[model samples]
Target: MVSTVFYVFIFLLALLSYIFIKRNNREPHKRLKLPPGSMGWPYIGETLKLYSQDPNSFFAAKQKRYGEIFKTHILGCKCIMLASPEAAKFVLVTQAHLFKPTYPKSKERLIGPSALFFHQGDYHIRLRKLVQGSLSLVAIRNLVSDIQAIAVSASDSWVSGQIISTFHEMKRYSFEVGILAIFGHLEERYREELKKNYSIVDRGYNSFPTNIPGTPYKKALLARKRLSKILSEIISERKEKRLLEKDLLGCLLNSKDEKGQVLTDEQLADNIIGVLFAAQDTTASVMTWIVKYLHDHPKLLEAVKAEQKEIGKFNDLNNLPLSWTQTRKMPVSYKVVLESLRMASIISFTFREAVDDVEYKGYLIPKGWKVMPLFRNIHHNPEFFTDPQKFDPSRFEVPPKPNTFMPFGSGVHACPGNELAKLEILTMVHHLVTKFRWEVVGSESGIQYGPFPVPQEGLPARFWRESSS
Candidate 1:
């Protein structure tokens, strides 16, 4: 009878334990709430609302209503938008491991799956180090003269009185600079081939991803395949020559994993294309905005011009190229670059996917939800800048509060080509202010978003080379 009583006691205890465990598991779900915002229509879920108006307005409206951390569904994914510096830091830096970088499958296909930004952990670290090393201040400083020469050549093309799309021209110039960084100096035929095919890819980058024949995306896919063939031939020749150069291509060719495995040729090509894509549009957009901003703010433009022309006069007297040292010391132009990056905010936000259920300030970000750190919103916030909408470079006389200025982004996945980009911008600015004069050809003062915010119709303008007196 005692044994039977003990058996009954054990069974009852086990039953109670199971119930207790289940209730505790359910309790957190009961208590944790999703951030507050509308999910919008069923599967479509606010996608139309986002694309229907200025994206900035959409995000700003959301922030105004729901505060910094809020929930919304767009592009068919539920997302948590973080606009505050602390929130951005939490997602991008301190707690980055919990959020993996995410991109659409279509984009990955075009840019290549192995490109640096699409990765995490060791693979990302390895690629980033290689890219950063190749574009480091040490490496790029050597290319100052080469970049200046390219800037001069490009500026020579803009002297025609005919209206020119500043952004389009800047894209060409930045692409040339990108080519220089990647391959040192490429053959003209190869350069032309790349320019031809890359133009197709650029046109289709934001197009609807469909396999329908004759569509822009289809042409882009074909061009991408052709680009691979061209890259393969280039790689074969480099191997035949047994060269040990230090350009980005060389760095990729010579990289080895801990296991002594080299990156595949396909991987090499993806990153090459990725670097070109990275270097071109955003830099072009920012440079174009600088042109517009300088035109719009006469006093700031005159100040920048004065600074650049002084450097020009010195270079002319010494018969010396614009040295890297000179580029570093352009306080006025540098401030303008900083202000343009802030006001334009070309890379408005970046996307990361939650790897697990994560909590931020009592809000639950469920696994697989998209998390966006809205850099543009933070940039335009009045708390951070006195007159957020004004094109005032003087505001940059003092350094911005930490985490508030992330024009190049922050954390591990931040852009590796940023230094090269700034160099190109500064070089271009030096050439423009000292050698050329331009006038906006039309009265249109609106902005257009061809993925990045650019002035209307690429800021059509007429250029005239400043005559030597």
Candidate 2:
């Protein structure tokens, strides 16, 4: 009887211990608060509400109500929106390892999963260094004359009195510059083929991804395949020629793992396409905004024109192209570019996903949740810049507080080609201001999001070439 009683006691003790341990582990999450905000309706979340309004306004409203870090659901995913620079720094710089870069499977399929931005750790580090070296100041400096020529040709093609879409024209110019940086000098046929297919991919990039036979996304998928084949041909030709030059392709071809393994063709194509994709729209958007901003502010236009015209006159007298050094010295134009990037904030936010449950500032960021750093909100925050709505370039005269002005982004994943992008912008502005004058055709001042903010109708404008003095 005493033995039976002892056995019952041990059984009860084990059961109680199991329950206690389980409760401690499971109930902590229940006790922990998620950042405060509405998840909206089940499954759908606030996606419609977000898409229905200006994305900036949607984010601003949330930040105002819930403070810098808030929780919300959009596009069927739980998301944490970080608006403060500290929070952004934590996620992007310090604690980046806890969050991995994330993108939709469909988009990943389109860009090819091998793109460096989709990776982390060693692969990302290796690929980023190569890209940075190719786009470094030293390398791009040598391409100044070539870039100037492309810029001049682009602006020259805009016939006087012809109403052209400035954004469209800028896309062409940026694409050419991207190609120049990638291939040094591609043959005309190859360039044309790449451009033609790339336009299809660009058009479909933001389209609702679907596998329907006639859908834009489907068409993009087809074009992507063709691009792969074309790239293979290019790679074969390069290999046959044994080209050992130092362009991006050359760098990739020559790069090896610790084991001395080179990147596969798919990896090569993906990164090449990735660089082109990154280079095109964002730069074009900013350039378009610069044109509009210059037009809207006549004094600013004259100021930029004067700065550029002086350089032009000097170059013309010397019978020289716009040198890399000349491109760097335009303080006035440079400020205007900075101001434009701030105003547009082309890359409004970036997406990262939590790899595990994480606590930030006493709040739980549950595993698998999306974390987006709202760059536009941080940029436009009145705390950082006085009169955030104003288009004054002088605001940039004093540098913005640290971590508050991330035009290209911050940390490990920041844009490798930012210098090239800036160079292209400065070179284009020089050509635009010195060689031609333009008028915005429509006075309608409104913003359009072609997955990036552009002026409505791509900033319709009429261009007129100035007679040589």
Model 1, residue 336: C-alpha shift (Å): 0.2
Q: Relative to the true structure, how large is the alpha-carbon lDDT of every model?
A: 0.93, 0.93
Q: In candidate 2, where is summed lDDT lowest over 10 consecutive residues?
A: 24-33
Of candidate 1, the 10-residue stretch with the lowest lDDT total is 23-32
lDDT digits (tens) for residues 173-220 of candidate 2: 999999999999999999999999999998888899999998999999
Q: After superposition, how far is residue 127 of candidate 1 from its true place, in Å?
A: 0.5
- In candidate 2, the residue pairs with backbone N, CA or C atoms under 3 Å apart (3 or more residues apart, or in different chains) clash, namely none
TM-score of 1: 0.96
TM-score per model over all chains: 0.96, 0.96
